[model samples]
Target: MKKLINDVEKVVLDSLTGVQAAHPELRVDLENRIVFRGGTPRQGKVGVISGGGSGHEPLHGGYVGTGMLDAAIAGEVFTSPTPDQILEATRGVDAGAGVLHIVKNYTGDVMNFEMAAELAAVETGVRVEAVIVDDDVAVQDSLYTAGRRGVGLTVLLEKIVGAAAEEGLDLDAVTALAKEVNARGRSMGMALTSCTVPAAGQPTFELGEDEMELGIGIHGEPGRKRVPLASAAAVAKDLVEPILADLDFTSGPAIVMVNGMGGTPQLELYILYSEVAKLLKDAGVTVARNLVGNYITSLEMAGASVTILRADEEMLRLWDAPVNTPGLRWGA
Candidate 1:
């Protein structure tokens, strides 16, 4: 409720003004609220784009840049972008090689992106494909999604697939790789506190001081169950166990992420990662690459999520590719 803002309805618009000022490398469309990679329509390269509600910063928007997303559409807080907005992004980025839509498994996102794809094909004749990331091992259905709600693995998917597209892979190849990445990843999260939407001006949910919600969604949806607050090591077990049970990560190298839900400190994240790394090691899951930070987050929510991707050599190589984006960058 005590957020720094002029008006509730203008949060997205106002913050986008800052994004435009800060990251000139990204072209921000104030009218449509779409952030496109600067000098876009990179001909012959498969265009990669993703979108969802706001609040999850550095996600669909913060990722637009070299070796990542070509465009990212932003909606109101926790609200899906309309089909018209999505179609505009698709049209703006396509340069003959086609476009890939990386969508979370939320119901609104899925439907709207689907509509946009169809519209792009019919109206602009731009080839469009989509990959739905439903890697959350926490629940099969949530308040916003029919299947498992996509969580932290989305960041991994965008980076890997964007690298593939940057490498000049065709639309079909990029889409296939994206699907493969989604298939290999699994995620689980826990929340210590709930987030407040700017418009609502109050916390989305309440949690007792001595309690934590395990297997929480990014949008403050109810988790698997609430339990007594536990130690970092115990919390790591609560997250890693379901993911390991869902897939066999021991077969090969894995890419792991310990992501903050927004309000958790970097100090606490590292402590949690220490415990997570040990658990993966004990489980014989070799972590070849790792990210520990606030990559995807709910608005000022006190929590963290774990994402594990069972990776192959190609995935590792692409993951190491140069990326220049606000959210993630290295080797650029």
Candidate 2:
């Protein structure tokens, strides 16, 4: 594949070296494949940690900072981090209060994080709780997960729950907030093109020029179905309808995100966002806060995903809280 890297095996390590150099605010543990916020384990704050494969940039790693994740472990591309690596991250960030692991609803991620929590509890005596995000309404099952994949809501969860952790909520309270967020959010994604994994040196999947994959997962796996490509408005409808139908978003203010899947340009994403916003407005859903950009991505995949969270006053307040991270930063 035509990717910029020294070698296939060194991609994660080399990219992490660049992360360490680019952002001094983050402490990078290259050997262990963990990224930590500088000056971690903030006395009594609940530490937040999330991890996954390496191709999805500005995800677990880009989110390590003052108001989001305190630490993130990196796996190989689209692979789950080992239990030992996760245990290291949990132990490193435990501040006596406890640590919260925000795991996406992928089989590998869920199992690995669960094992890590057990190991950390036994070996380090550090309290650990986990919040599994299964916000994608794309499918009831997928190759990588038993239920819906976590998808875009994981981003919203990290920001909102991270604020709670930063505000010194105990581990239990933070975990509760995370669960609440997951219950209130839903997501759907579509893909126009496939992504190429550097190690494999080929696109993960193939799509005809006139075709699109609806209900796509982030790993470049096959989506729910393939359909003829359509207008942005039609695509937006396909995304929003399932979300609104699955959850009653009109009853409250909503936080909406129109996320690009790695390769889609901001201009295209904004156009798609405009369409999504219009649909939400017509459906009587108030958009309290909106994010339009690439947050969670599949490696150079061309597509977009929409995430909607039914926000109560507390969730809205948390959304407005100050956050400082490489991926998302505002009011910090």
Candidate 3:
């Protein structure tokens, strides 16, 4: 329950204020908690808008910039944004071409974004395409329980899909690329500890110092099971093995990201990545490119997730393309 904040109700607004101050290329709506690129609504390009809860920093919001998302709406911590907020973001960023909504597969996010897209079609004639990322291999991908959670792979999805849109790929092509990216990626996470949600004012779940949750989803959801904590190398094996087994990333060159879940330290993440690299090499899988850091996170949770994307030349080309954002800036 220890959080440094003036008020729980003001967390989203204060964060938005700080974002505007730090990133002048961005515009913030104080009342609506919507973040827009400084000069959005490009005459012919597709408008890319994405949002979810506020806890996952650099997610829907941090990706807003010249080469990524056009706008991002923020919801309460770990809660989905309202339909009106999403509708506002969609309509505000819509240009003549169309708009794309990068929605995570969480139930609340899906429902609210779908509602907003319906409203947008009626009100503004904005053709909206939503691509849900369900790259977490922990979930069963069943017809129940919200399907799979969108974890680390959403970052790669936004970057690649945004590039396609920027190149005038049209709505169908961009959407196809997005779906392809999602389908080709798989992720798995493990948490050594739990986190407090600020507004919830308590730990979402409990874990002893020696207990680890193997298949963790974001937002403190129940993992596959709890077991005694293991070494970094062992933990990396557990996380990466499941991801590789679920997807055939070994078929070709791959892009890997050993992402920390907000609370894990860099030293430990690298230790884990060392093991991941060795394992891939042992399996005859070529590591074309890799990112090891906190790209997507569950607020203040001590854990990490490993994502592997089975990359073709086109995907790798987009991955190498220029990207400029507060959280991730490179290649440009």
Best by the lDDT measure: 1
TM-score, every prediction: 0.99, 0.99, 0.97
Query: Candidate 1 has what TM-score?
Result: 0.99
Error of 2 at 210 (Å): 0.5
What is the C-alpha local distance difference test score of candidate 1? 0.96
lDDT score at residue 269, model 2, on the 0-100 scale: 97
Tens-digit lDDT track of model 3 for 155-250: 988988887887778888888889999999999998988888888889989998789998888888888879999998888789888887889754
> Residue 253, candidate 3: how far off, in angstroms?
1.3
Q: Could you tell me the TM-score of candidate 2?
A: 0.99
- Evaluated at residue 154, the lDDT of candidate 3 is 93
Cα RMSD (angstroms) for every candidate in the order listed: 0.6, 0.8, 1.5
Runs of candidate 2 with Cα error greater than 4 angstroms are none
Each model's C-alpha lDDT? 0.96, 0.93, 0.87
Q: Which ten residues in a row have the lowest lDDT in candidate 3?
A: 138-147
Clash tally, candidates in order: 0, 0, 0
Expressed as tens digits, the lDDT of each residue in 1-332 for candidate 2 is 78889999899999999999999999999999999999997898889999988888889899999788999999999999999999999999988999999999899999999999999989989999999999999898899998989989999999999988888899999999999999999999999999999889999899999999999999987787899999999999999999999997648899999999999999999999999999999999999999999999998999999999998999999989999999999998
